[model samples]
Target chain A: MRQETSRAQAPIPAVAGIGLRFPHHRAVREDRPAIGWLEVHPENYLGGGAAIACLEAVRRDYPVSLHGVGLSLGSVDGLDPRHLDRLAALVSRIEPGLVSEHVSFSTAGGTYLADLLPLPMTEEALETVCRNVEVMQTRLRRQVLVENPSSYVRYVASTIPEWEFMAAVATRTGCGILCDVNNICVSAANHGFDAYHYLAALPAAAVGELHVAGHALRELGGGRQIRIDDHGSAVSAEVWALLAAAVARFGRRPTLVEWDNAIPALDVLLAEAAQADTILSRERDHAQAA
Target chain B: MPKLRDLQAGFAEVVLAGRFDALAPYLPADAIPPEDRLAIYRNTARAVMTEALRLTFPAVERLVGRDFFAMAAARFVRQAPPDTADLAEYGVALPDFLAHLPEAAPIPYLADVARFEWALHQAATAEDAPSLDADALGAVAAEDQPMITFIPHPSVRLLELATPADAVADAVLAGDDRAMAAIDLAAGPRRLVLHRGATGVCAEQCDADAFAFARALFAGATLAGLVDAAPAAAGTLLAGHLASGRIAGYALQTQTGEP
Candidate 1:
């Protein structure tokens, strides 16, 4: 058994950072880009190898955050113990600034679907998510933030709004909320809701981090389209505006510019981070004025 | 409204089996038909699994064209979806899956290439450990040398393949069609040992006797047993592995009643 105080935790700063992917591992390790921090999917570094060794080297210079893509926090079958153990071991090894997983479930009936499947906004789901979050926190011996997912379809059984369900998870579990601004934009456009209202509903105190990413618009003909959260291209104008709104509502947080597919060069990601910093700075100036 | 577990099961059915009826009742009515909306999630799930396989088995994808690879990957995903979140561990069954696939039978060497690639993937991602100290081995009493059992590095893998898949994989990865064409499909079984060192993953072919010796040593055979298994090259092979740092550590086997 490992003690909670065995490793010291690094706190993420309230500034823009980049999501570190495999392609840029060499560049980031050798060049050591002048960025605020770096976040990675803990799943990638769970198994030791060149990947973990590289992460160890990079962690020396930057405050790394483990953003998990497959914890399946909302699954009714319960969390996978092996996966949790691997993640806990990684946390002990990395001692990241922050650790997080999605509000959706990817495993069902003993099969991992590989995509973040949406959960019905029902009381049962709320309970399941809270229970899973508590389990994760207990195993990891630390607080974990749950990020809201982007969805194209809504369930008829959903009673509570998406934002309320998210806020409830934080309130019930004492965990933080990682507000993905682009997901808010994509889900709002797909479901015909106000993104600003979604942002305002989140508990200010529970908001610990923010994410902004690119999404694709898929047309269904006849002047109708669904915004897919593919994170393929540049952040759209609408998402940038929504991110600005989130910053204003949540204040400056450790925001990340996420680009998973069609990732560009290191300079391009840094440019996106710089763009987010501009909005974050404006919020700081506004707070000073207030 | 279905229970949360039932809802997830139904959603998974829709995503994995394309059975929209299971989830149709839960979806709210929309301008886009419910099935079409559900397809978005389905497509993303398939794409994610496909991409995971592509990352691990790029040579397999190159051996088969993109469209064919995608089709095969989709089939494999549906048949054997991953049970864990760590994708690095996914796709372990693909080589066997392809070996039995009728379409892939035309390319008889494809499965072997995939097996070799999986070995490469495992070697690259296996845990890191300290190599054996050469000086420590010399200090052991000469009498105990025969009882010394060598421990192989965590990343070492020994494979006896029926085809010359390594050369084909090399050619395919390099996109040298001429080199790929020159490979003799009739080449007999080849024995290989793969290990990761300070530089990167390395694979080498060895003679049958040496292969058996290394395999036994890795399987925890004492020096005496290793020599019994392959008397011709046990000493030379052990020395070579020690020099290459393949042996991580060693232990002496005590007498039966000794503590």
Candidate 2:
């Protein structure tokens, strides 16, 4: 039996937040950036050392969200018991406002590949993903949001559209959707789908969070190119436009600006989050006027 | 349609094993060749796993240079893919993997340098534990002191390397070319004890006897056993370790009447 602590769970505001990576930990701690909130990958903190110690300190002033990249929620083998237990322990300790994992698997044949692999979006994959999401929710004893992945490949066997698959997971498992607007733009560009239609397919009420990140456009020969969700730069103007449309549809959600690689200074990340906050604020006013 | 399990297995083959044909039947052809799309996944997987290794073994990366490190890391990733998702727990086998690689033969000390860096990585993330209580030891009678056993802190790691791996790591990390040149490659068997405290991770070199004693204590040896194993400086070294919070807690064993 799990013992629930009396620590008050901080609710994440419908504003912009920054993905707290290792480089910005000192600045965030010492200078105490006036961001709306903070988000981090729980896997980094589970080992319990200086990283967790830093997260614990930062968690004091901000409403943190655990955005898991390694849960393999779409695995056919089901959720990894140890991973779930560790995540549950972290949730109990941190009492995060929102917990989320991708709508993709990172492990197969008992080997963790360490990158979010795309699912085929077939009925079988949907069943597997929904089952795993339910197991995750049961173990954590809370609703978790599932984020859409940026994919370069699509399978012929995929009967369901990607957005429909995301919606099915939320509907079947009673989970929330973490609409990564940047992923929608990237995947739509890669597979030739409308990013707005992808957003429209999702249940607006189920969208509890949004992620906006930068991507790299890699060029192939013959003027062909692919959008890579590298999350290593500023949010693109196309993604910002798609995010604006998503905000208009979903009204307001906890949007996060994620920059994982080639991370710039703290001010750059804050500026990205501020950009998101501006969109979120604009949407809130639009809703009020309507 | 193939079963989800089969689909995933085929997908893994495509991404990890580089067997693009394994999933060719499932992927619909378009302007982009199937191999090109699959290459994206393959590249990303290799890149992310390599990045994880680079994080844990920066000294090794620095020693071998980035290109060589990436080549070795890619091979290691395929050979011993992480069984768990917590990437911090990943790449435990890279040191041994590097040791056996043919290309790594030229740099004999590279493996040991990796081993040292891994120890430092482990020390940074190991679980926190309280230091041994001094008053509790005081409560024990003098005669029972020898029977006392220690509980080592989770952050403590004892390493005995055949090369001066610590010096190599320090020089490489500090980017001190002169210090790197000054080190003698023939130095044998550096014993170190690494632990995390209030400030950060610390690695300290010790003599043979002190290393033996600390290893024994970490292995759940009774004070009597530790002294018997390394009798020269058992008392002095034990006090120093306790003072430094290397011992998390301790237990006193009582002799059975039959024994």
Choose the strongest candidate by DockQ. 1
List residue ranges in candidate 2 displaced over 4 A.
Answer: A1-9, B141-144, B227-232, B254-259
lDDT of each: 0.92, 0.90
Candidate 2 lDDT over A168-255, as tens digits, reads 8999999999999999999999999999999988999999999999999988888889999999899999999999999999989999
Candidate 1, superposed: residue stretches over 4 Å from native = A1-9, B139-141, B257-259
lDDT of 2 at A139: 90
Per-residue CA lDDT of model 1 for B100-163, tens digit only, reads 9999999999999999999999988887888898889899999999999998998899998999
User: Model 1 clash tally?
Assistant: 0
Per-residue lDDT of candidate 1, residues A1-290 (tens digit): 96554322378999999999999999999999888999999999887679999898888888899999988998999999999999999998898999999999999988998889999999999999999999999999999999999998899999999999999999999999999999999999999999999999999889999999999999999898999899898888898999889888888999999999999999999999999999999999999999
TM-score of chain A of each: 0.96, 0.97
Q: What is the TM-score of chain B in candidate 1?
A: 0.94
**B123-173 in candidate 2: lDDT tens per residue?**
989887788866679988899999999999899999999999999999999
